[model samples]
Target: MDTRSLVQYELFGLWLLKRMALRFRCFAKDERCRGSSVIGLVCSWIETDLEGYRFGDNLIVGSMLDDLAPDTEDHQSRYTSSALDAVNAASIMLDFLKTRDVSLIKEIADLARDSVDMLAQEMISDDLTEAALENAIENHPLMVEELSLQEYLWSLAGEVAGSGDFFGDLIRANAEVEARLMK
Candidate 1:
């Protein structure tokens, strides 16, 4: 699959996890509020760490978009597609939250989980970025075979740093995810 496709998959997975984390922190973790005590450490991870990954993605892509010449708009467009996809996903979350429909959030998580599962089946290519994305999905927060949606939210949010520098953001997210996995 192309890098953009992989990014989309990752974003969807990330979105679901983020949504879950936000929900768990607000509702799922509190039994008195009808939440489960089983929400656990994963909730902490999401709140403390994994949130704002998409903002990091936007920072990198926005920087890239700014660097391109007006004539190279098409090239810039290719790079921006994934970022746009991420924005759309976030809007979906915002819409859900505006109504405060907790149960509906499950649908997003399910979609995110499904996206991760679909991505795990994708074949990796010689491209380094694609390889990195694939590796990211196959491991850490994702662990596609049996993805823990809750943990994924925290891991990605904590790990993903939406920086203005592209490579810098990638490096940061990788290092953060690596450290989180080690624990």
Candidate 2:
């Protein structure tokens, strides 16, 4: 898979997991809500090969088995580590969401923003000023149409800094789904 597709997959997986976490929260509290349904949905989702479905407009061409299976079997081999990371993040986020009374979500979002900023700053380096970076990028053209790597990283940092509202996003998505179901 291409870098863009891989990113989309990771993002889509995160979004799906957040949606699932919300549903799981409902199941945990509401007696009427069937937890089995959620479990079954998760099972089906994970079991389905990457190529079995369409992610946005792009169609994945290979099975996730390609990722899960290692070329050489060893006691410690990295297979599906990326997917597992997403799953782990989702699980931890769900734990935070469960503590609705606390400010864990906000803290987590802030920490994420800070982490991204730090990483971006490290990638950008202090030696080059913003203007210098821009001048360099303008002078040197990449084959790709998009911004240079430094510019892209800087843009991402700016975006993360501007919108570090994880709790709001989750709430808004849930509210929209509820509103749609009512209709």
| Candidate number achieving the greatest lDDT relative to the actual structure | 1
lDDT of 2: 0.34
The true-versus-predicted C-alpha distance at residue 33 of model 1, in Å, is 42
TM-score of each: 0.30, 0.24
lDDT of 2 by residue, 39-73 (tens): 33433443232224432211121222223222223
| Range of the 10 consecutive residues with the lowest summed lDDT in candidate 1 | 31-40
Q: Could you tell me which 10 consecutive residues in candidate 2 have the lowest summed lDDT?
A: 57-66
* Candidate 1: tens digits of C-alpha lDDT, residues 86-144: 23334334433234344444555555454444434443443558668666666744444
Candidate 1: where are CA atoms >4 Å away? Answer: 1-85, 124-146, 149-183
Clashing pairs in 2: none
Candidate 1 matches the true fold with a TM-score of 0.30
